[model samples]
Target: MHLPSRRPLLTGTAVTALLLSLSACGGGAAADAKTGEYKLVQNGVITAATQSEQPPFAITDSAGRPTGFAVELMNEAAERLDLKVQYKTTTLQGILAGLSAGQYDIGVAGVGATAERKKSVAFTTPFYWGFTDVLTLKDGKQDALPDFDGKRVGAVSGSVQEDFVHREMGGANLVKFKDQTALITQLLSGGVEAAVLGGASADAYVAKEPVRIAVKLASLQGSAFPMRKNGDPRLLKDIDHQIDEMIDDGTYIRLYKKYFHDPIASDLIKERPKLAEQVMNHPDLAPSRR
Candidate 1:
């Protein structure tokens, strides 16, 4: 969770130059008068960006195609909008910048919405809530977050947990990795005493490794798709509408079970009631349920 730098808005000369380059390559943003939707980079294709290897969230399968919770959710939204999606993988740190530069139409890499993040890109209503957790090798020297004080701790270079490490555990030596797997590997190998990760990423590692959650950090608001600020209205609306539909029709819960191998509960919504209510207004998740 590194605090993002001030990002230049996705307008003016930079956007114009990027669009011109895309048009020369046979693709560019063009608004369709009839449907009121922006033509994507590739005709009929929504250019999506994601970080590779973030487990149950976004990962490349054996076929070298993106397949995971986030990717599948993006696919579902595109399907509802009658658009095809082509995924491009990059380091986690690059996803938002790419979107801001107009290099991607949408980004779905389990991005959590934060005030810092909102400056770089527009976030859709959150589709899933995530918790931040600390991980260490089972029976290792570290048993709690405090154990890492003034010691090395690993975090995905640009993730929210990395920001947590910096702000809350300022005395700890921060070691940043390009991906969560690498961060976990460092912790397992004793390169670091503990690592901070999203709860799901920690779960994925603990399933096969000798690791245990040291503690759960404060939960995040939720994960959402990141788009260029002031991007296509129809595209944003379609994605948001699809998310609302998923919650009402139970597709969101099904996807949660499929990826988490467990059930989705209203507890997630309860954890951040006001934020969730404002962003995700599905009737199925009423305040009474919380």
Candidate 2:
């Protein structure tokens, strides 16, 4: 999943300028007095930002409409709240920077809700859990993380996988790309000997490309939607409530099955214990026994 950057995507003058521009475009607003709800950037609408190519989480379809697991969940929540969503596609960095600038009300693209990220943005309750995977050419001999040490390894710039490369494979020649599409492109063309991706995303690519997972790292924190820090208490609460309602009604599980075939992540049921019974009842959703 996309993790927070150790460095700010926008700082000082750039942020100030961006904020000023957003304000001029009617960016900020007061809470609604009648409903006690947070006033949206555009009344009755959610301005959401997401990366265009983070598969199974956020991706633009052939028709240019945004559609993916995260996007669908957000859409469902908005529908429940009687609100409309307007999506803008950009790099993951742009999504983070835009939220800080009040240019977007929310960001959804398989974002990991790490403590470092919470310092800048508040997150909705986690909706997905996944591992990290290392990918190499289908016939490549490298089957383990250590085998790639001292070789060129690529990851999306600012993603947790990049941090993994630095911390775990310190000897690697690390290459960073702006997005997953470019990362996979480089991996396929031999620009990098290996690439790290979110587990489900790697699976999506592997299904279609001549690549295979060389390593599967332990799961990380769950993925969630991000909003500006301390912004819109009501909206945050509402989104979380909607997510809970979805789970209770089996809507979340239905959507999970729509985009993923693997059993629901055990960590997810651990986090939301209510899902335990559902998983137990549905054989397909149950984790496989070793």
The estimated TM-scores of all candidates read: 0.78, 0.85
Compose the digit string of candidate 2's lDDT tens values, residues 214-272.
88765568888999774677888788777767776899889998888776665566555
TM-score of 2: 0.85
Pick the lDDT winner: 2
TM-score of structure candidate 1:
0.78
Query: lDDT tens string, model 1, 1-290?
Result: 22121223343444334334432442232233233457466667789998778988899888889989999888887786778898899977788888888888888778878789898898887766656778877886555566678889889887888898988788899999988768877787889888888878788888989988877654546778888785675777777766556644567656766887432323344332222322233333322211
Q: Which predicted model would earn the best TM-score?
A: 2
Candidate 1 residue spans exceeding 4 A from truth = 1-36, 261-290
Q: What overall lDDT, based on C-alpha atoms, would model 2 receive against the true structure?
A: 0.79
